[model samples]
Target: MGDQKGEVVGGLLDSVRDVAGLPECRGICKIMYGNLVRRIKLLSPLFEELKDGRQELGEEELKGLELLKRAFNSAKVVLISVNQGSKLYQAFHWDKVALKFHQVTEQIEEALSQVPYEKFDIPQEVREQIELVHAQFKRAKLKVETGDIQLMMDLNVAQIEGVDPAVLKRLSKKLQLMTINDQNKEGRAIHELAIASGNHGDKIFEMSSLLRKFKDCTHQDSLEFDSDEGERSPLKHRSPVIPDDFRCPISLELMKDPVIVSTGQTYERSSIQKWLAAGHHTCPKTQQTLLQTTLTPNYVLKSLITLWCDSNGVELPKKQGSCQSKKPGRESGAVDCDRTAIDVLLKKLADGKPDQQRAAAGELRLLAKRNADNRICIADAGAIPLLVELLSSSDPRTQEHAVTALLNLSINESNKGKIVNAGAIPDIVDVLKKGSMEARENAAATLFSLSVIDENKVAIGAAGAIPALVSLLDEGSPRGKKDAATAIFNLSIYQGNKARAIKAGIIGPVMGLLRDAGGGMVDEALAILAILANHAEGKAAIGLARPIPILVEVARTGSPRNRENAASVLWSLCSGDLEQLKEAREIGAEDILKELLECGTDRAKRKAGTLLELFQRLDAPSPSSLEQKSDA
Candidate 1:
C-alpha cells in the first residue's frame, strides 16, 4: 500500500508538468484548461510535501492521497481529450466538455477537503495557498460560452445550407480546419480517437461525419451549392416542417406512395414495406395487433400531398422505376404492381415453411440487388435481423440466400449499423466457417461492408472473425480470397485488430499471394500488408517472412498502387533495423529507388525518398569514425 501510494504521487506530479506544458487552447477548452492548470499547480508543492512525509502520514492522509490521485487523473484526461480531439467536435460538444470540467473540479475540491493538511508540517504559505485554491475550485461554476454556441450554430447552418463558403470559411478558421491538409490531419486524429474509444458510443462516429462534411465543403472549387447533381440536400436539413398528415409515420418524410395498414395507419410504401418485412404483426404507430396484412392505397392522401408540395414549393419524393408516358417524368406505378407480390413474399419469409422461406429469401436477394430504393424499403421494413436469423438455417439454399441478402442490404450506410447492432458478427463468422462456398464468400463481403464503420471493427474483431477470415484467405476460391482480403484489410485498420490479424497467422497466406503474381490478389494483399506493417508486431512478423526481395521487386516493377504499398512496407521494415537496410542494399534496391524519385506518384516518391536517405545514413561515416580520423 505504501509503494502504491508513492507511485500515484509520482504519476500525479508528472501529469501536473504535462498539463502545464500543454500549448494554449482556444474556445471552451481554453477557459477550462486555464482554470485547471492554475489549480493543479497549487497542488505541486502540496504533492511534493506529501512525497517527503508519505512514510510518516496517517491512514486518513493516505486515503486522501488516493482520492487526490483519482481527481488529478480525471483532470489530466479531460484536458488531454479536449486538446487532442477535433476542434470542431470540442465546440459542438461544448456542453459535455463543460460538464466534465465542473465534475473534475468538484472532484478535486472534494479530495482536498478530505486531506488533513494541517497535520503535516508543510510551510504556512503553501498550506494557505492550497486551501484558497480548493475554495476557489469549489466555488467555480462552468458555463458553456456564447462563442462556442455560435460556433456550433455556424457548423449546423453550413451543414444545412449546403456548403456556404462564408460560413465554412469562418467556422473552419475558428475551428482551425482551414485547409484540406488540416481536414485530413483532423480526420486521422478522429479515426485514432474512434479506435481508442472502443464501444463507448456514437460520439466519435458523429465527429467523423461532421469532419467529412467540412472536407466536402472545402474541397469544392466553386461557390455555388449545387442541389441537383452535386451536394444534394439531406432530408433532415430541409427547412420546411412537413405536415403531420402528409408525412409517413415510420419515415416522417413526405409520403410518395402512401398506403394504409389494417390498423388504419398510413406510411410511405418503402417504410411500410420495411416494417412488414421485419415480421412485425402489430401496427408500428399504435402497437395495435394487425388484423390483416392488407395495405390499401390512400389516393386521397396522395393527392393532398401533391397539392401541399405545389403550394409549399417542396418537391414530392421522386419515383424509382420506368417513366410513365402520361406524367412525362414520373415513374410508372411499377412499385404498386410489386407491392402485393412483396407483401406475399414477406409473409412467406415470416410464416411460411422451409421451402417457402428458401424461395422468398432468393427473390428478396434479387430485389435488394436490383435498386437502391428497394434496399431501403427492405431494410426499413426490418428485414435485416430476419435475414441475419436465416443465416443459421438448416437448409443450405436458405442460408445462402439469407447471407447474400444481408450482403446486398449492407450496401446501404444506414443498414450497416442495423445489421451490426442486430448481433450479426458471430453468426456471420459461423457462416464464414461452415456454410457453403457461396455463403462463405457473401458472408466475408458482408463483414467488409459492416466494418466500414469504425466501431464495428472492434466488435467484429472481438467476435472471433479474424481466424475464420484468415482461413478463407488461405483456402477459398479466387473470389472468396478477394472478399476475405478486403474484409481483413478493413478490420485490421483498428490497432487491436491489426495484432489479431497477425496472431491469426495471416503472414503466410499474404506472402503466398504476393509470390503468386498471377493470382490477381496482389493489389488486395499489398494493401493489407501496408496497413498491417503500421503495427509493431505486424512489422516483426512481415520482416521474419523474408519479404525484402519481393517488396523490392514490386517497388521496381508492379503497378502504381502496388509499388506504393511495397515501398511503404519496405520503409516500415527498414526504418530502424540495420539488418533490413543492409539486406536491401545488397539486393540492389538503391538504383530502383533513385529512378522512383524521378517518376513515381507523390506518396510513392515520398516513401522512396525516405528509404534513399536511410541508405545514405547507412553509408555515412559515424561520429566515432570522424573523431578517430581527426586523431589520426
Candidate 2:
C-alpha cells in the first residue's frame, strides 16, 4: 500500500541487508529466503506484462525493462545459490557452499549479458528515481561480491589496542600463546575482544551476541570446544562434524565407494557411475573425455571417511553401484504376448547370459507395456523377481526396462506381493530418486501400485518416496505429473503418510495441476486434496494454494467424478466456516453449486446443496471468493 511500485528496488536492497546478516546456522537459510522470493513474486507479473507488450512501450522504456529483468533474474540466481548453500549448510558442508557461490556468480554473469545501457533515453524524474534506487542496489551488490568474512585465524586482535612497539611485541607473543579454536564462536569472540581491550573475561557473552547480529558463521556440525578448558577440549554435548570435502558434487551426498575421476575430482563412485552410465563420457566438472574409462579407487579418502564415521558413531550411507547404459530398449514389432512367450522371457531374464538377460528384460518390458493381459501373463509366469533383479542392474536401460516392467506387472494385485517380497522397494526407491525422467515416472507409478498392499505402505515411506513424488508433481512432464499425483493420492490413503505428503509441498502443485490438467488427473488430484482439506494443515495449505476458483470452474464443467470431487472439496473447505462460504458465493460458486446441485450426481448434489445453504446464511463475501470471481 505504501508505494509498492516506487519501493520495489529499494525494498530489495533492504531485504538483502537483513538476509545477509542472518547467521549461516542450520535452518537459518530458510529464514533468509522469503525476502527474495517475495520480491520476485511481486515483480514477476509486471515483468511478464512488459515483455509481452513491447509494442506498447517506447524503445528506451523497453530497454529499461530489459535491464531490470536482467537484474531481477540475477537476483533469482543469487537466491537459488543461497537456497543450494542452505541445503548444504543444513548438512554442515562448506566446500559446496563455495562451489554454489561460484556457480551463482556464473549464472549472474549470464543473466546480465543482455543488459542494454548505451544511451538509455529515460526521463530525468524517472532517471532520478532509478539512480536513487541503483545507489543502494550497487552497494549491496558490491557487499555480496566482496563478502565480509572475518575468519578468526586471520584476525590479528593483539596489536589493535595501540600498544607499544618493543614491549608490545613480547606482549603479542604471550597473547598468541593463549589460543582459542577458531571454530568456537563464543571463544573466538572472547579472544578477539580480550586481545583488543586487554581486560574483559566477562565479555565473551557480549561479543558472541554482537557477532551473531553482525555476521553469518558456519557453526560446527556436531562438535564444539568446551570454552573453559584450554587444551584440546572436546564438546560436552555435541557430536563430531564431518569434513567439508566428504560429499560427491553430483549427489551432494556422502561418498560411498569413493572414486577419483580422470579430472582428479573425487565423487561417490555410484554418483559418477550413474553419470558415466547415463552416457556422458566427459568429466562433469571439466567436461574432458575420460578416454581411458577408468575410475581409480580413492582408498585414502574412503579410509578417512570411514575413520571419521567410526569415531563419531555415525552410520554411513548405503554403498550403491554405478549406472548403466542409457540407450532405450528397441521397440520391436507386435509380439503374441501369450503365456508361453512370457515364460520364455522370464526364464531368459532369470538364467540367461547378461546380453540375453538384457534382451529378455527389454522384451518383457515391451510386452507388459502393450496391454493388461500381457501384464497378467508376465505375472502368471512368475517374472517378478527376475524383473526386480534387473531393476538393480548397472545398465540404466536395463534398470528402466526392469522397473517399467515391474510397474506394468504390479497392475495385477497378485504380482504386488511378489514384487515387494522380491526386495523391490529399495531398488524402486533408488530408481525414483536417480533414474531418467521416464524411469522416475514409471517408478513413482509403480510405487503407487505396490503401496496399495497394506504392508508395502510402510516400506515406501521408509524408503523416502514422498519427496521424490512431490518433486514430480512440482515439475515434470504431463504424464509424469499425472502419475505422481496419482501416487500421492494412493499414498495418502494411510493417515501417517498424509502429513508427510502435505509437508512435502504437495498442495500447491496439485492445485496448479487442477488449474490446467485434464482427465483422471483432475480426479486424482482432487481426491488427494479432499483428504488433505479434512485436517487443519490441509485446509491452510489449500487456502495458500489459491485454487478455489479453478475448483469452482471444474465444479461447473468437468467429468462426473471431477464435478463431484470439486464440489465435495469446496464443501469440505467451506463447511462450518462462514468466511469460506461467503468466498464460495463471491466466486460465482453459489451459482455453480446451484447448477451442480441440480444436475450433478447424488454425492455432488448433497455437497453443493450444503455449500449453498451455508453461503445463503452468511452475508460476508470472503476475500478468496472475491479473488476467485475476478479470476474466473
Candidate 3:
C-alpha cells in the first residue's frame, strides 16, 4: 500500500507539472499554484486573514491577482485531465510547464521594471509576504521539472521580490540620463540631415537675392525723395537779373510818356525828366534830387507837332549839312542874318526874364515872326489882360505882338471865352473895323482863333463882331479873307450865331466871296449853308432872305465840291420838311445824284438814292385825292 500511494503522489505531481507547463500559464500561478495551494498549504493563512479583515486590494493589484487565479484554475483543469491516464498529454508537460515558469519570471521582471515605486509605500510585512509567494512559486517550478525537492527548498524568494531603494535610485538616474541623451541625439540628427540635403545652401542663396533686390528698391526710393524735396523749394529766392536803377521813380513800374526838364542836369532814363516836368523835381514828401536838363519827348507830343504842321499846310525845314566855320565870332555884317537872329531872339522872347522881354519882342517884330511858347509863358505869368490892353498900342509892332500872343492864348477854347468876356472882343473888333490892312489881317486871325469856342461864337456874334469879320472876306488880303471866312464859318456853325450871321448881314459877303470862286471861299460858303439848313427857323429866314436861292444856284452851277456840300445842306433841310425835297430836286439835284453815283462812296450813294426815292414818293398824288379826282 505504501508503494501504491507514492506512485499515486508522483502521478499527481507529474499531472500538476504538466498542466503548469502549458504556453499560456505565467506569473505566480505558473510557478507556485500547486505547491502553495496543495503541497505546502502556504496561502491558507493569507486567505483566512483576508476573509476575516475583508481587506480590499488596489485595482491594478487585483487585476494581476485575478490573472493569476485564472491561470491557476486553467492549470488545475489541465492537470486533472492529464491524470486521467493520457500518456501523450503527460509526455512534454513538465518541459512545457518549466518554459512557462521562465516566461512568468521574465514577465515579473518586466512588470517590476515598468512599475513606479514612487507611487507606493510597501510595509516590511507585505514585502515579506510577497517574497514568500515568489519563493514558493520558484521552488514548485524547480521541483515539478527536475523532481528535486531539495533544490526547491534552496530557492531565495526575497531576492526575486520587492525592489531595493538603492537599485530604484540607480534606475531613476538612468531614465533621466536616457531622456537628455535622446534630446541631444535628435538635435544632432536634424542638423546633419539639413547639411546632407543642401537645404541650408538654398536658404543662404535666397537671402542674398532678397538683400540685393531690397538695396535696389531703397536706392530708387531715395532718389525720388530727393527730387520731390527740390521741387517743393520756394521760387522767391531766385533773383531776377533786371537792374535796380532802370525802374521808374514816379509810377514805380516802367517809364512811359517821358519829357524834358529845363533845370541844369540830366539822367540816363526819362523818369526823372517826367518827374521834373510835372513840377516834382524834388519829391513831394522827400524834397531831394533836383531833376533837370533831361530830354524825353513823349510819343503824343511828337504826334501833336506832326498834326499841327500838317494841318497848317506848312513845309518843314530840310536837314542841313554842317556849316564850315569861320574863326570864332568874326563875321562880315553884310549877310542878312535876320533868320538865325530871329529864331534866337524868339526863344528869348518866350522864356526871357521881364527885363529882356521888350528887346526880344523888338527882334521878333523886325522879322515878322512869333513863337507859340511866348503866348503860353505870358498867359502863365498873368499877362493875358495886359497883352489885351496892349492891343490899342500906337506902335504897330506892339499891337502885332500883343494880338499874336492873344490869338495864341485864345486858341484854347476855355481861354477864348474868358478873353472875350474880359472885354477883349470889342477892342479886337475895333482893330478889324478901323485898322490898316495888316492890322485887319492880324485882328481877323485873332478873331478866327477866338471863334472856335461855342461861347465865343455866341459872344462875338452878340458883340457885333461878325460884320467886321465878313467885310474882310471881301476887301482884305487873301490871308485876311481866309481868316475872316474861317471866323464866319465858325460863327455860322452855331444855331444862335446863324441868325446873328444873317441879322449882321454877313451872309451876303460870304455869298459874294463864294461867287468869286477864288481864294478857297467855297468851303466857308458850304459850311454856312449847312448850318442854315440845320436850323428850321434859320432855313426859313435864309430862304426868305434870299440865301437859300443862292445856295440852290451854287448847288446847280458850282464845282463838284460845292455841289456836294450844297446837297448835304439840302439833305439836312429835308429832315425838317419834305417840302424842301421838291425845291432840292428842282435845283437839278438829279445831277448831284448822277455825280454821287459816279463818284460817291457806297454810303453816300445809298443815302442819295433814299432821298431821291423819298422825293418821288412825295411828288406822287395821294391815294384819297386820286379817288376824288377819278370821280370828278
TM-score of each: 0.49, 0.43, 0.40
Of the candidates shown, which would achieve the greatest lDDT relative to the real structure?
1
Q: Which of candidates 2 and 3 is the stronger one according to lDDT?
A: 2
Q: Of 1 and 3, which scores higher on TM-score?
A: 1
* lDDT of all predictions: 0.78, 0.60, 0.49
Candidate 3 minimal-lDDT segment of 10 residues? 192-201
TM-score of 3: 0.40
Candidate 1 lDDT (Cα, whole model)?
Answer: 0.78
Which of the numbered candidates is closest to the native, going by highest TM-score? 1
For each candidate, C-alpha RMSD in Å? 32.0, 33.5, 66.6
Ranking by TM-score: 1, 2, 3
- lDDT tens per residue, model 3, 48-152: 333334234455544443344334434454434323321211221345545554455444433333323223345456445645655544544333533322223
**lDDT score, residue 419, model 1?**
89
For model 2, where is the 10-residue window of minimal lDDT?
145-154
Evaluate model 3: give its lDDT: 0.49
